[model samples]
Target: MNAVSTTSAERVRADLVRARSARSARESLIKGLLFLAALLSVATTTAIVVTLLQQTISFFGEVSPLAYFAGTKWTPLLSGDQQSFGVLPLLWGTFYLTGIGLLVAVPCGLLAAIYLAEFAKPKVRKTVKPILELLAGMPTIIFGYFALTFVTPVILRDVFGIPVSEFNGLAAGLVLGLLVTPTIASVAEDAMRSVPQSLREGAYGLGAGRLQVALRVVFPAALSGIVAALILGASRAIGETVIILIAGGQSPSMSLNPTGSFQSMASFIAATARGDIPQGTLKYETIFVVGFTLFCVTLLLNAVSTRVVSRYRQVYE
Candidate 1:
């Protein structure tokens, strides 16, 4: 009987050890998979950067850096007419569109986030959030069409009584802004929700009014997150292609007017690539150079956002 009892105890111990070993193995597998995924993402980004740099260097070899930077004209097809590929116009157009888009997105998105997070009932929020998310998921080309066919012509002709141009940066930027608002709202709302309940309670304990607590305590605490969200939205606006391609004119004008037609870097690339430019041609390589510029701009924005978020991060007990 003693031997049988000892045997049963040993079996139970063995089973427990085996179960722990299996769990550890599963955890290790999951961690390894995640690590590999992260590594792959980094590798892909690095490859893209390297490829763009290589192509850009080749393009600069054919076209002088001075001409690319200083000259105003951008006639890649005409070699004898003193063609200039000054990137400033394209860069300015990008910023102009991005600024306009952000101007529209930030206020609307932040307000929506405030309502959803602080004011809305659960049922209302549940319905609204999904609908907003659906808007985000809609294809950019669809938004481009909406901007071109519906918004621009209607508003410009009907409201302003002006002949609407086929391409308008303001319309594109506005549509892009609408598209990005949901993303900002979702991020900002999550950030706001992450505020500690203790902070709110403390404000209440001090006899603070609801608006005072929200403005003074909550908003300040969440400012870092809100800034990060805005930065991300800006990044999206900068990288947007389809809406700009359809609504923003192909002309890389240096105009800052919201109503004027302009081309973003992404839109320019899309337009250029659509032409039958031979592979290994100057124009072909220029696309890579533009892409490289776009990538660097977005990277810088992300880095700034990261620094700002870190600097202003709030600590709570």
Candidate 2:
């Protein structure tokens, strides 16, 4: 009897060992696949950086960086006397558009998020949130056309009497604001929702009003995430190409007036791509330089988002 029991115990032990070994093998395989996925992303980013840098070097070889940075005009394809390579005008155009977009988006999106997070019933949020996010899925070119046809003619020119031209930054910026509203609202709503319910309850228990609790308790707790959402919205605003290209015009000029027509970095790139710029020419190289500049700006925004999130995020047990 003792010998039989011993044999059965050893068989059970061997089976358990085999099961653990199989699990170990499966885990190793999953880890390897995850590592490969990470490597693929890294490799793609490296390739983009290398390609941009190589052509940007060619651009600098043709033009002085000082002239590129300081020159106010961006007429790179004109005759000898007309040609200039000033980058600031286009950069400023982009900044102006993004600022206008934020000006419109920040208030509307935040207010919408506050309503949805702190005041809306569950059914109302469930219905409204999806509808709001649906705006994000619309084609960008369609938004461009909407800006051109509706916003320029109906809103900025007529309703507000802003004196905006047919192709102006004001139209593009306004439409871009509507386009980015979903992103800001969704992200901010999620962040506000993530605030601890206990904190909200405690505030309510202390006889705090809904507005006061929302502002004092939840808003500060989720501020890092709110800032991140705003950064992402700004990033979307800056990276927009189609709307600015179509509605904001393709003519590069330096002017701060939102009512004026101007070209963004993205619009400039698109304009050049469609024109007579020959391959490997200075004009072509300028595109890569502009692209690199846009890349740097985007990277900076992402870094700021990371810093804000890490610095102010609240810890909960």
Candidate 3:
């Protein structure tokens, strides 16, 4: 009996060792796959940057950097008479649309997030969350068409009596705001949800009402993530192409008014390419320069978001 028991114990120990070894091998394979995916993402970004820089350098070779930067007009193709290439107008238009988009999206999205996270019951939240997420999944072109037909004419013209143009920045910005609202709402809600339940309970224990607890405790605690969400939404608004291309006018104007017609950087690229600008010409290369600028702006926003999120990460003992 003693001998038999010893043999069974030895067999069980060997089986445990083999199971641990298999688990370690599986973990190592997962780690390798994750590392490879990260490397591929970096490679893709580097390739795109390199390609844009190469084209922009060739463009600068044809058109002097001073002419490209300081020129007031942007008439790249002028009916065999005169040509100009300035990017300031496009930059201004891009910022104008982006600013308007933020104005509309931020307030609405933040409020929605606050309501859902702090106030809503579980049943209400479950029903509403999916509906909001559905907005994010909808195609951007549908928003563009809505802006062109339903939103622009009806709201801007008949309701407000504002002189609505066919391709106005206001409509584009408003529609873009709607498109980005879901993203901000989802991120901000997640941030609010991450706040410690203990902090909220303490607030309640101190004779604080639900509103006071949410406003004074939860909102402040989640400020960093809220800011991150706003930055991310702004980045998405800035990089948008189809909505701006369809609703924003082809004319790149340096105007601050959302009511005015303008062209964003993405719209400019689409418009310039539509014309007969040769692939190797200065006009064509200018597209890359604009694209590079857009890329840098979004990259900076993402970096700021990363730092903010990292700094505010809650520590546990």
**Which candidate should be chosen as best, given TM-score against the real structure?**
2
Candidate 1 lDDT score relative to the true structure: 0.87
lDDT of each: 0.87, 0.91, 0.87
Point out where model 2 deviates above 4 Å. Answer: 1-34, 275-277
Ranking by TM-score: 2, 1, 3
Worst 10 residues of 2 by lDDT: 251-260
**Most lDDT-accurate candidate:** 2
lDDT of 1 by residue, 146-237 (tens): 98998798977688776657787889888889889999998988888789988888999999987777777787889999999999999999
Q: Report the alpha-carbon TM-score of model 1 versus the true structure.
A: 0.86
The TM-scores, one per candidate, come to 0.86, 0.88, 0.85
Q: What is the lDDT of residue 87 in candidate 2?
A: 93
lDDT of 2 at 215: 93
Local lDDT at 89 for model 1? 82
lDDT score for residue 204 of model 2: 96
